[model samples]
Target: MGFTAMGLAQNSISGVIKNENNEVLSNVEVLVSDAAIQTKSNENGLFELKNLPIGKITLIFKKENFEIKSEEIAIGKQEQKIMVVVLEEEAHHIDEILVSSIFNKTQNENVVKIDHINLKNIQNEGAINLSDAIATNPGVNVVSTGVSIGKPVIRGLSGNRVLTYTQGIRLENQQFGEEHGLGLNANGQESVEIIKGPASLLYGSDAMGGVLFFNPEKYAANNQTEFSVNQVVNSNTQGSNSSVTLKTSEDKFKFLVQNNYTTHADYQTPNGETVVNTRFIEKDFKVGTSYATSRYVADFRYNYNDLNLGLPEEDIEDARFRTPLYPSQKIENHLLSFNQKVFFKNSKLEATAGYVFNNRKELEAADEVALFMKLKTFNYNVRYYLPDFGKFETIIGFQGMNQENRNFGEERLIPNAKISDIGFFGTSQYKMEKSLLQFGVRYDFRIVNIHEFGEIGTEGSFQKLDKNFESINASVGFKTEITEKITSRINIATGFRAPNLSELSSNGVHEGSNRYEIGNPNLKNEQNFQVDLNVDYNAEHFDFFANGFYNSINNYIFIAPNGNTIDDNFVYDYLQNNAALFGGETGIHLHLHEIDWLHMTSSYEMVIGKLDNKMNLPLIPANQWKNNFRANFNVSKNIKNSFVFLQANYTFNQNNVSEFETKTGNYLLLSSGIGTDIELKKSNFNVYLTATNLLNKEYIAHLSRLKADGIYNMGRNIVLGVNFKL
Candidate 1:
């Protein structure tokens, strides 16, 4: 009779468990004891613990290589509510390793290399944008015309030598146009990854400088329903930024709807001078589904962006009349894509396809001038994984793009182009106990077509240059563990970049650069030789990682000295010229839990490059450094809330001015912020106070476009924001 009573008690205490996405997990192993309960997350990441005392209890969650998660909860009621848990990805390469891509140095097998900047650390340090955050990394530099636009220059290469992907697909921007910024919205991004050197084995052309990758809020595991609003009011500029997202899940269905808007009036320098008046808007939405019928998972996404460009800081003086002369441009983009995965006995297969449409318009306020351009792109990629013989992986993909540019003039200006490209890529990973080795290679083929424009003046015939360019690209890499806490990786690769429509036909002033940019019809394709070496270290609670890179270019098509002239006032003709480049980047991090309620992280980056003769690269960033300090403390116990933290950052400006161009003197910028998390019955409230440029430093950034005008960076700024989760 007593044994029967014990059995009834064991069946009395059980509750449901769900993953962070709210999906019910199945097949999870749950073990309950007198004081603690242990369980394994199910296929859907759900679990349940039954038959427990109504008092304080401890829970532990674990999986193969995932970080062990533990928490204490009070069981005061008979029927406990369902609990939702989040499992963060952990760095597997090294315990003490501090990789740049993952905020806390989590590792992934698909990634052979990574370059990352933690937003939390940089947010407190007065850093803005993905480029500025990465500036502290060793071999990285921002080849910027001004603050409005910044491009990553790794090992002295960018543009065609590098590749940039938004989400996971190629981003088609007039990046080769010189005036174009990264094109994607940066303010709301979670983190950015830069794969220095060659990534051609995975990403195709324009990846010579490496790859700039980003994931929006939806990419974060714990990003469910969040709402945030921020305002920055200062002596130099007035701005506001806000974003809201709604996410929900039921069994195997999930969706995320998000919207973000930012607007900043004209910003002035500390010198009390107006630099530039700019503003923009962006909105994104996505939905995903997972079906367990046939051991398959599928996801589909669609996003849209509408951006309006205003006059550049250098062109604001003539904003009205220079509308046509200046680079005031507008761009609208729409994208649709889908990815599916099929899990087999010991392997998996993945397939992905996407389509993108982009439209560009340029207008001048002076005489009713307008220009229109459109680009359409399509892409497809597939990968298959197999076990047994060292676990092999292979990938194949193809991309096709068509573009058209039309200019409104007295007669007619039309430039149309088409591009077709295909590539085959393969990689193999060998695993032996604690040892791992990986190698990959890719081949690319591309062709271009150009149609003639109306006959033009003696300055230059509007004739088109039609030709087919072909090249072979390849890459191989290997990674190994020197010790339990140390890992090393090395890679050597080849890359290529074919001239895009803008590079081959554009013959006007680039609105963003506020300068005349001429295109070369006879420009040949550019090629690159790239190499990388990296080391990762991990400890119980701390991590550190470093990356080194070297890149050499042949037929490096840069803005060459045309020796000719255009219009009347501007001189110095710019066409495509061959150049060489090289450089590297490194970073570190330290985390502590001994203090219980306090934590801190610190990091830095440096980059340098040169042209053909190893001379100083014209726009290469000067040596730079950044440091951050932060602390968190608990404030309440009833609602499980905490007085989050206070953080401060100091940045050392570059002293190594470019010899090719005048360099700005070194300067210092500081910032501080405080945040709090409040727990509610069913939601969470977060609030923060941030002060930027605390010292009110009156200094100009070397990368600022207004440097020539003696315009300083923005003066002290204060921002107040709030976030709500439900």
Candidate 2:
């Protein structure tokens, strides 16, 4: 019988659920008694079972496609209420070990999903941004000003089609500005989640490509204050960076503050020649605060950053590219957000509000008045959900956003643009014995108002315009477990994206890409329909997953070569074009051995996309794959509290190339690292050294946005880093 019949005292069992690798797992089904009382975990891997009788109970922890676990738990009348649980990957048979990489995964009969890249992977790479770490994934590539400014490009989609976020808040960078970087840093972050294929059911608009969510560490435990620091030095460019973080939490309050600074010189090629070397300086600061009571919780965060990075510039008179564009890539950004939650009985309500401000300045490649731009955005959202409504749960939400874009340049005085959108979203989920069904829908109403400023030379017309857009997108998905160890999932989703400023008013040289891009005023929003499927299998010692997806776009806005035009100058216009898309990705993870004190993990991913029945799509990579091997060893006699890890990754060459551009040849890059941990009096110290492009391969990636003559990825770089935790 359920709890009410038992004359039990009020108490709780609270704790975080983790895997052997110390990574959190969400939605793990925990059954507390033989009567089948169950509870699920939150995003942070936190869970609570309240109002339980103070007596002996049998606890059962089971998840779809995972081995069932049964344990005897005694609930003493005056015992502690919190206990941490760690689950181990089970093996299918003798001599066949299950693989459980640090990657997070969920499985059903038809679908297996993996979304998180943990700190273990992040520590093995020496990079400036989240994109650098993400690029290690098989189906993922980057389109950056150079290696240092990478942004994820899934399949054939990049730019406005992809969406990025920090924690649960939307990223505020001027993403529509193709020259801008994704800007999120990996320092002090716990992990990053990549939602591939069509995820429009949760995120709106740009889900056509995919979404990257960076999650920071949660609050510390037991009101204890903890500090962490990372210092890194790179050999390729003689660069260095450092990050510091402080976190603490009490029963009622929690917070984290982090700061990072980085400086790098121009990078080199395998031959050690400075290739269009540029210097960059960056600083980032973030603070997050949270408070919670029995029925109420609140969270707030503030992020700030300042960056000055150089770009390539071309000289009109000499037909030669210039070094270190006078303006450089200077950007200042600030973001603030607040979230509140109220709980009653079996339902909860959440409200979120945020503001983002960004400012950027860069010198024009040909014209004078330095190009400067500013963006201000304000957004709010409200959602409510109720659990225990029979076998189904329902969620409803509303969101609103307002943004203003301002541009200042010498050639043409483009007026500021105001953009606004309002949306409603809802999702419902039902669970059967071995299957789950989910349906979600979103409706958006968007408007844009533009004003013209100054005179438009005989080159083009200058006018004011107003536009409105209304659209509805929906998604349906199913996940089921065929047996206790195999699961599958399938989904169909639709998405829409509104035009941004860069696509509607730009008319100058884009220093970042070394291209003179002109905007089209008559462009239309793009829409997408997509379907995805996946499979996951978990054995005693091996875990693996495979996923496939196809996406098609209506009114796809692609840049096309439209001859040349003569104003006071002659320039080629890249106009918009319609197109269709299809692609998929698959990966598998394996765990080698534990008894021998050895652990091995490996994975590979493949992605493909074609447009208009053609094999070529701009800036999309074909056939990307990565193989990672890591070994952990402990040193007990020589050093106290010491361990070492050796890791390596190999990225295969891409075969996909654009028809409009020269065919890109494939290249192989290799990276490796080693780290050791030591315990000191009151703190812990960890040090590591990483070498990238270990073989000194000198080739360009097909998806790189580097200019044909300028901007080269760094070659043969070494990084030494140390971390102190207390």
Top of the candidates by TM-score: 2
In TM-score terms, candidate 2 sits at 0.83
Worst lDDT run of 10 residues, candidate 1, spans: 1-10
Q: Pick the candidate with the highest lDDT.
A: 2
Model 1 scores what on Cα lDDT?
0.54
Candidate 1 error regions (>4 Å) = 1-111, 116-156, 186-190, 219-236, 279-293, 313-327, 391-414, 456-461, 569-580, 591-604, 638-660
Q: Please report, in order, the local distance difference test score of every candidate based on alpha carbons.
A: 0.54, 0.65
Write the residue-wise lDDT of candidate 2 on 436-507 in tens digits: 887878888888898776566432234577888778988887888878887788888888887766667656
Q: What's the CA RMSD for each of the models?
A: 8.8, 7.0
Give me the runs in candidate 2 sitting further than 4 Å from their true place.
1-114, 314-325, 364-369, 409-415, 457-462, 514-516, 565-578, 593-604, 613-615, 637-656
The Cα error of candidate 2 at residue 248, in Å, is 2.4
